[model samples]
Target chain A: MIKRNIFRRTILISLFIILFSASTFIGILDIKLIDLLKLDREAWHNFLYFRIPRSVSIVLASAGLAVAGIIMQAISQNKFISPTTSGTISATQLGMLVALLLFPMGSSFVKFGFAFISALIFSIFLMVILNKIKIKNIIYLPLIGMMYGSIISSITSVLAGMFGKLQTVQSWNVGSFTLLVKGRYELLYIIFIPVLLAYIYATKFSIVGMGEDFSKNLGINYKSVILLGLVLVSIISSLTYIIVGPLPFLGLIIPNIITLIYGDNLKKSMIDIIFLSAIYILICDILARTIRYPYEIPISFVAGVFGSLIFIIILFGRVKYGSK
Target chain B: MAQNKKLQTGIISLAIIVIICYMLIKLIGVRSLFALKMIVKVRFPKLLALTVSGVLVTSASLVFQSIVNNRILTPSMLGFDAIYIAIQTIIIFLLGSVNFLLNPIYNFILSTGLMIIVTLIMYRLVLQKSKNNVVILLLIGLILTTFLNNMVTFLQSIMSPDEYLNLSAGISISLTNMNLDLVLIALPIMITCIVLFYCDAKRLEIISLGEDNAINLGLSYNKEVIKHLIYIAISMAIATALVGPLSFLGLIVVNLTREIFKTNNYKILIIFSGLLAIIFLLLGITILEIVGHITTLPVIINLIGGIYLFYIVIKENKI
Candidate 1:
């Protein structure tokens, strides 16, 4: 069993690295590896500054979001309750809007702060509401979560309209990695901390996900683990929104497909899940960039289209397999 | 209800009249005749569109709840709005700005036809089996809507800026600004649909009583289900295609009417909820008018209605 798990882990990481390199080579500006080896200054600068940052940011964002999703689904014990469905993305957008309105000249870090705070607040609010509700129907949680997101998003749009910032918000809503170059992308590295933290606390999150009673019996502090999950989700999500953009449904789908293939072992499957999410997002990004060559489409567009379709398949897959 | 029928009818008739008169006076203010003519020319079709669209949306939603037997579901949840947006995006992408904007009649027919066909296919597939699993169907609809919307957004990203500019005016859900010409043309069709809804009210109430009950009452449950799907598809397509999509107006109007009027009668529910929709819509338009063009009413309605929906769902869980 140990040997097989190691083999799978190695394969996943290798696949991710290979795709990451491939995505770097497909943008509008071509920078060949052969040119870099020949000590070409332009190739080196473009690759090091533009291609590498964008590709690394993609992997980081998706992996972070995927792990965050696992923790969320585990804690809530609902596959549908990802950051996107639970209003985290919308809350970040609201924060981004407020950051734009109040601190128009502030650095991206300021915006990140606003986004992180609001995202944390919104998810906690959702948690409180979910705690009070009886889970007679599993599907109802995600449905309510979506309604919560829409309410916040509509409010964001209304505010944006009043402030004449609708166009600005629209640009961000496109959710692409087109703008991530060297200096602008350092903030994304902050995502690594939450991801590391998730791994450190994976067992607790899994126990918490089982149920409050199960968690308390195992001597884990249920509320604090729940808070840690929210904070991890918020940090990863908000940072991603600031650095990249709001890539819808990635958080929901990646962990779902991962858990499906690998089972619900957070400690065992977390690394594999991270690697698979990176590969999935890298593939999507590569397709979007090439589909309309010389003019890249946003990643969210491709992800949303395919993500929803995959979600439908999974919905049926669950029924057929009766996995739960 | 038998005892209160006269009182309910009298109150409903009065409320409808009061709302209409108030909206008309608001539209045709006592300004100069030229200004009145200009205002009437612009706002009259909008008022007609809003009123009829309100009735259409609410009634379609009422029938939709019956057909699915779920109170919280809205047609928009099935992504009807996303489909409309996708249709507009595809039109602009394929035909350019001139062909799309120049032929409003063709656009109406094409848009409404496409929406109806799409919804019909979905309803048939979803309702055939798994009758007990409505949430899965709702999830599928919601997911498909997201997929369609993302496709539209991707297409629009690659569109010529001018063509996208044309789509912007047509696609976004706005109550303040509309193609009055299309509204005028669609008025007759919308009125006929309202009449058809009134005609089918009793049958719809029976069908809502679960499939076994509906079947046992000498109603061909399958036939009634098909008819329900057809009327819902046409009305919803026309209404959404006429304006943009109203995500929660139907939910608020239908549920509020059910709560306040204390009526299980589908006949009274149609008119009662229709009036509630009109009042809600007119109030929205007038407020937008008063605030004067900084924001659209649909987004605000979405905000209010979504909060109300969350409240209802939370309350359900509490019980």
Candidate 2:
């Protein structure tokens, strides 16, 4: 146990260092706010004000998404699953497309609200369908999710094509942290705080992970807990997508790494998730900004590509141990 | 007797599906003699390419799954998709969008042939040892995927916005732009594989029972498996080249085929699986066209696949 804790601490320290170095690189390479905007003192002050809100937005969005991912994986009992991978992102895209087409004059908040609700509905419908299927093997799970997600994505693509909005849709779907200015960032915070509290309602989620009969014996309300978890996950995921677009693999990679390192304890994973997700986003931000000097890389691809490697490594290790 | 019935059903289903597809395409203003001529000239050829490509992919996936004794694996686990995507990103970055289809047929054949040769060599080396560990293979694939993704990112970063737009726009699935020559080449390769599969139908069933069982049955399991892998590489190359990677499409189709067909016969299963893929792909495209048309076909496919995936997740009660 001592050895394990020491190893984990080492990992955390290294992660922090990498994140710090990347940020330092960004700071050194990127033009400062004053130089970037080349504005007077008043404008500079306004920029600083917005900067704080954007930082707040990043923190809230990452934490909320991380927690939602944890709750989702725990309840669903599948590490390979995430909102991004499970069609939530597609649903959000669909919602956003509709909002763009139907409510050109609507407020961002109203648009975000609609997106969140629709994504939640879609996710729940998916979960219900999943529950109905009598699975013969576990492999069927991801396969089915992949298929379902593909179908939704196909729909989104077809719709985008017809509306002549494919280009816009693609741009919107490619996640980035560069656009989180003042007004947009506040909306994320408003959504984040309440959802954080609602996560407590899903304490039974980990219990549900213990199996239905086991949970029933413990007098747990499995259905309601699952429902609450789904709602929380969907809301947070949709809002994040609306704010920063859909991040690939962050939702899967963070929680799974947290669980692998911190043990399967949900609360502990939650804590790790908060810090790790922020660090992840920040590092991705650095890579996005600095990779090409002036041009920014989309953060989604960074997380997906890198995070999936980490996931595969862990999976490989598991297989090795199992085979042994 | 059962084999005869199965063969008859297979022929009937294939014919019906093709006719329906033809009718549907016709109904969508391909009705006039001139339009029919146009479809034959333009659409039919492309559609034929897609069909053959689909057959190769499904059959390859089925054989791969059987040999590995795992139902849920795709050749993408070999990192070929990553390599394909990486090559694409780099080529686009270098060439910009200026007649991007410059000798697509040549490029497709060359890259696919190169991939096949290299993978076959690696597969041989791995198979020479203990068979490829599913997880280990996946890890290698993952690592390669990461490396390629990073390279693509680097390329995208350096690329101008116009270049990036051209690259990414063409990156995802769009079957309208396909290479006829590559499809023609894939046709013969697929036919050879199907004939080979037919020749070894019994052996494949025995192999699916497991390595030990197959060995007990005096089958040269490794050789047969390697043959299948080569076939898979060819098929996957063709399909991926034509349509990019549609991961769950084949997985869903093959499983649906097994579920509905309720048979373990490889010969029957192959035809059923191929027909099912065509029907589903056309159906999906039709749905996308008829629906709000506000989204992409892939997004819709992902949504349907995801919901099904989630259902499988909850029901199985495993991570």
Candidate 3:
């Protein structure tokens, strides 16, 4: 068992190294390893200023989203719930609209603040609603979240139309990594704090997954832990959205794939979730850039295509495995 | 007797609402004979498009919910709208900004034929292997919608700004900007499809009693399901092509019909559903007109319909 575990770890680490290097190197500008060795000034400038920041932002956004998904699934005790399907991302988009309207010259910090507050409120509202309903089929939960999301998004679009900012918001909503630059993408670093908090509270989240009664019986502060988990989720998700736009289905799909492979113990699976998320997103980002050659497709579109395909496979696998 | 009285009151109210809507559209601000004539020409086609689209969506939703045995499901869940958007994007992408390709006649034929073929393929893949597990079907439908939406977005990204603007303008379902000639063509196709659906009302009633019961009663359940799905695909395609996609109008209209009429008869359901849909559209359009058409009708419908669906799902689950 130890030997097999070590082998798996080595494979994962090597895969991560390979994908990280490939994604960092493969962009419009050709920066070969030989150029790096010879210290070519132009290649070094592009690598330092553009490629590294782009890769860092991609890793941070995917890891943040995946971690947020894990925290959300743990708290809600539903495997399918995520920021994309739930009203969280749309609420943040709405908040961004409000920010753009109210403070046209505001910094990213002000926008992030508005988005975080709205995301928190909307996600908590959804949690309360989910708690009240006794859903027999778990699938309805995500469907309801999706419908709620559409309503929120429509409201945002209507407001954008009223202000003639529809095109701006539409472009912002489409996730892309090509917009990242050295100074522009530093806001994504804010996610690291919430991700750290998530790791600290991972065990309590697992207990919360067992229900309030179970947590209380174990003498844990159920409300605070759940609140903290939600706060962390909202912060991570909103920050990612503000920096990288919405990464559709990444949250739901990554955590689901992680739990399927590594089991559901949050403490043990946290590292695996983070690493796997980075690798998955790096591969998707690489595909997005290379699929149309010079003109890049949006990262969300590529992620949506791949994530939803895997989601369907997971659903079928559950039906076959769980029923038998 | 109570059900009959309820149906009578519903129909009466629906008629009154339609009449009021017609007056608001035709004579709200008419000043002269020339203006009246102009108003009638524009308003009549707009009203016809509204009525046709509402009927198509509502009837399709009712038939879909009945067949799926789940009131929460709408035909839009089957990704018909995404398919419509994708076809439009491809047309504009390949042919550029040509008016000939964008004409309602060509758009209708292309969208309906493609939607029917795609949905038939999806039905075969989903229903071929197992008993119709609705949850699985719904998941597949949802994922397929996301997949197709992504495809559209990818295409839109590559498109020039002018072409993209044109595509976005026609993307939403709006009665204000509908093609009058296309409405004339779509009205006949929509009516024919609904008539076929109405003809299968008895079979639909049987299929609603669960698949096993329908099969035990000597009905070829799969064959009937396939036939109704084709009918639904064609009507939905026509409606969507004419007015873009109204994702939740059908859900709101059909659920209101079931609540008000409280009937199992598809014939009564179909008629009242059509009436109620027209009333809903007229009322929505009237409100939009009052508000100076700031937002389109589907956005309003989806906002309210989605909230109502959320409420209904929570309430039903509470019981």
Q: Each prediction's DockQ?
A: 0.55, 0.29, 0.56
Q: Rate the local accuracy (lDDT) of all candidates.
A: 0.82, 0.67, 0.83
Please identify model 1 stretches exceeding 4 Å from their true place. A28-30, B1-14, B17-21, B24-40, B124-133, B155-165, B173-181, B211-223
Clashes of each: 0, 47, 0
TM-score for candidate 2, please give it: 0.79
What's the CA error at residue A265 for candidate 2, in Å? 2.3
Instruction: Report, to 2 decimal places, the DockQ of model 1.
Output: 0.55
Error of 2 at B239 (Å): 2.7
- Tell me how candidate 3 scores on lDDT: 0.83
Where does candidate 2 stray beyond 4 Å?
A1-47, A132-140, A198-203, B2-10, B13-40, B68-86, B114-131, B135-180, B220-227, B243-262, B271-319
Ranking the candidates on DockQ from highest down gives 3, 1, 2
Q: Over the stretch A153-235, how does candidate 2's per-residue lDDT look in tens digits?
A: 56776666777776677567566667775666677876656455655554577788886788899999888888888878778
- What would the per-residue lDDT of candidate 1 be over residues B4-41, giving only the tens digit for each residue? 67757765776677566645654455567866675567
**Interface RMSD in Å per candidate, to 1 decimal?**
2.3, 6.0, 2.2
Q: Rank order by lDDT, top first?
A: 3, 1, 2
Which model, 1 or 3, shows the larger TM-score?
3
- A200-259, model 1: which lDDT tens digit per residue? 999888889899999899999999999999999999999998888867788788888878
Each model: TM-score of chain B?
0.87, 0.85, 0.91
1 or 2, greater by lDDT: 1
